[model samples]
Target: MLVLLPPSETKHPGGDRDPLDLAALTAPELTGVRTELVETLVKLAGDVPASRAALGVSEKQDDEIARNAALWTASTLPAIERYTGVLYDALDVRSLTRARRARADARLAVGSALFGLVAATDRIPAYRLSAGSALPGLPTLRAVWRPALSPVLAALPGLVVDLRSGSYAALAPVPGAVTVQVLSERPDGTRAVVSHFNKAHKGRLARLLATTTAEPDDVVGLRRLLRRAGLHVEHDGDTALTLVVPAV
Candidate 1:
């Protein structure tokens, strides 16, 4: 099974001397668009004010723009290690055994505005761009990405568990891919959507799926696996699963 994860805004910086090699990333079909976006970002970085406005960053975060300026020559880190936040922190990839890490490398892929989609082991630099960012002289990111990314995701094999947030998911829609929703179960038996800890829960779920021996080919099997792992999972529909957690 392939689990699609959202890229994090907060990333661990610095890597080995090797720079980003677009051809080495997964989904070679996206190389053209990736290269286009990267070049545009590098050019935009030359104008800090424009870069800050376009990327929705403040002067305090100017380092991010500098990272984009050096994108082509910057060192690289594996995608999984590069992304860090509540979600990735919960995934705790650094603690996984070598065998489980191998499994994660095979089953996990990240949804990126910059790269389209990159495998867990894909080496990438720390660059700043959001799914909503609109670079000068280019179409909306959604417009640029959907046409190119959707087809590639649609053609992937096995069950796809899409855990991307709304914006990234909009970049590419995977028809028939099982989607997940995190809900908080109140003492009154009513449930509401989780907000603050949603990513944390998804991260744990991703870790579970990555390490499990079961290969769930469909929603039914996927739910079974989560249930077996002690999560309160319920069927939302044929193609969606709801994970119920205690209200915080």
Candidate 2:
């Protein structure tokens, strides 16, 4: 099964090894768009004020622009290692066993604003680009991405579990993908959409899915595996899942 994850804004900086090689990233078809976006970002970084305005960052974040400015020359880390946020913190790939880590690289794909989609092991540099950011010459990111990314995503060989948030999901829609939603189950047996714990639950779920020996080729098997991992999961029709966790 293929599990798609969303990239986080917070990242670890200054990798001392390697540079981004678009050909080395999975999905060879994305090279054109990747080159276009990377060049646009690097150019934009030359004008700090314009970059800040376009990226929706405050004056204090000029360092972010510097990161983008060195897009071509900056040191790189694997996609999983670079991202550091609530979700990634919970996924914590570094703590996984060697076998699980190998599985993670094979099964996980990160939905990215800059690179479209990258495998967990893809090498990338620190840069500032969110789904909402509009660069100087490009159309809406959704417009720039959907034409290429959607078809690539839809053609994947097995069950696809999409765990991306709205903006990133908007970049490319996977028609047959089964999506997971995190919910809070209250003491009174009430259920509500979870905000704070959403990323954490999804992170844990990603880890579980990545490590499982069972190959869940469809939603039923997916749900079964999740349940076996001890998550409170509910099958929501054929297209979605609800993972209920205790409210904090």
Candidate 3:
């Protein structure tokens, strides 16, 4: 099974290796669009004000723009190591054994506005861009991504568990891909969709999915796997799973 994850806004800075090489990333079909976005971002970085406006960043976050400016020449890190936030912190990839890490590299992929989709081991630079950001001379990200990305995702082998947030998922629709929803259950038995701790739960779920030895080719097997792992999983539909947690 393939586990699709969302890219985090917060990332670890700097790396010890060579710069990004789009040709080396998975899904070579996305290269054309990836090159276009990388070039656009590098050019936009030259204009600080425009870059800030386009990227939705404030003056205090000028360092983020600087990162974008260095996109071509900056050092790179594995896609999984680069993204850091509540979700990634919960993933705790560094704690995994080398064997498990290899499994993660094989099963995990991240949804990116800049690159479309990158494998966990793909080397990428620190750059600031969001799915909602509209570049000065380009069409909407959805318009630019859907036509190319959806087909690639739809043709992937086996089951697909998509854990991307709304905006990223909007970039490309994966037909027949299973989606996860996080909800909080209160003492009175009422439940509400989780907001603050959503990513943390999904992070744990992704970690479990990445490391498990069992291959779940359908939603039933997927639910069974999650349940055996102690998650409160419920079938919302043939292609949707709900994870219930104690209300905060």
Candidate 4:
């Protein structure tokens, strides 16, 4: 579970000392966490396309994505260790149809979760055809769920909560779980810096800025918030508010 300082408590503590203590964290560590979160989600999405083309592929080709999802699930979260084994056993279930049904259900859950995460981050939904819902047969269900669910569960509400609160906590997923891919902004040079921060911890980037455009006290407020989440603040001087970001 992640613990956060309430906004009220952080903003108005009676101490005159540095409000948030983030000197303990280094820049590289913060950047690495952000990169890992994004990369993991991307790979998970790639594992499941759920596109019409994927569905149209020959059985051999169609199963390839499923196989990758299975492999990824096997490698990532420990909670899925038993579930993956169940999947293996289901493949040989006396009834071929039942075996297929089981696989599909699992896949569907994974897919929905991943899609949700993608949507939360990018503000765009990933899957057009599927929503998070119950499915029919086993194989068909796994086909829909497994790919997206893990990533979405890893990110979505949890990751976003952390981002908004300015905490850089990692979300651990069940075994066979997928990592979340963070949505990236375009390469165009935007001046505002989006950041996350609070009172308990401090961000390094916040400390690095020199006092200039904004008032000294405003910079201090920004610094206190970032230090809690190991985030930073940046602005092009024109934007009304400075950008607080946990990662670039």
Off by over 4 Å in 4: 1-64, 68-160, 164-248
In model 3, which runs have C-alpha deviations exceeding 4 angstroms? none
Q: In every candidate, how many clashes are there?
A: 0, 0, 0, 55
- Inter-residue clash pairs, candidate 1: none
TM-score of 3: 0.98
lDDT (Cα, tens digit) per residue for candidate 2, span 130-237: 999989978999999999998888888888899999999999998889899888989999989999888988898888888888998888888888888888889989
Which residue segments of model 2 deviate by more than 4 Å?
A: none
User: Between the candidate structures 2 and 4, which one is better when assessed by TM-score?
Assistant: 2
Model 3: lDDT equals 0.94
- C-alpha lDDT of candidate 1 relative to the true structure: 0.95
Q: What's each prediction's TM-score?
A: 0.99, 0.97, 0.98, 0.21
Alpha carbon lDDT of residue 182, candidate 1? 97
> Model 3, 1-248: lDDT tens per residue?
89999999988998976988999999999999999999999999999999999999999999999998899899999999999999999888999999999898899999999999999999999999999999999999999999999999888888899999999999998889999999999999999999999999999999999998899999999999999988899998779999999998
Q: Name the runs in model 1 displaced over 4 angstroms.
A: none
For model 1, give the 10-residue run with minimal summed lDDT: 229-238
Q: Is candidate 3 or candidate 4 better by TM-score?
A: 3
What is the lDDT for 55 in model 1?
97
CA lDDT of 112 in candidate 4?
Answer: 21
- On residues 50-92, what C-alpha lDDT tens digit does candidate 4 reach at each position? 4224333344454333433333222221111112222223222
**Predicted candidate 3, C-alpha RMSD:** 0.8
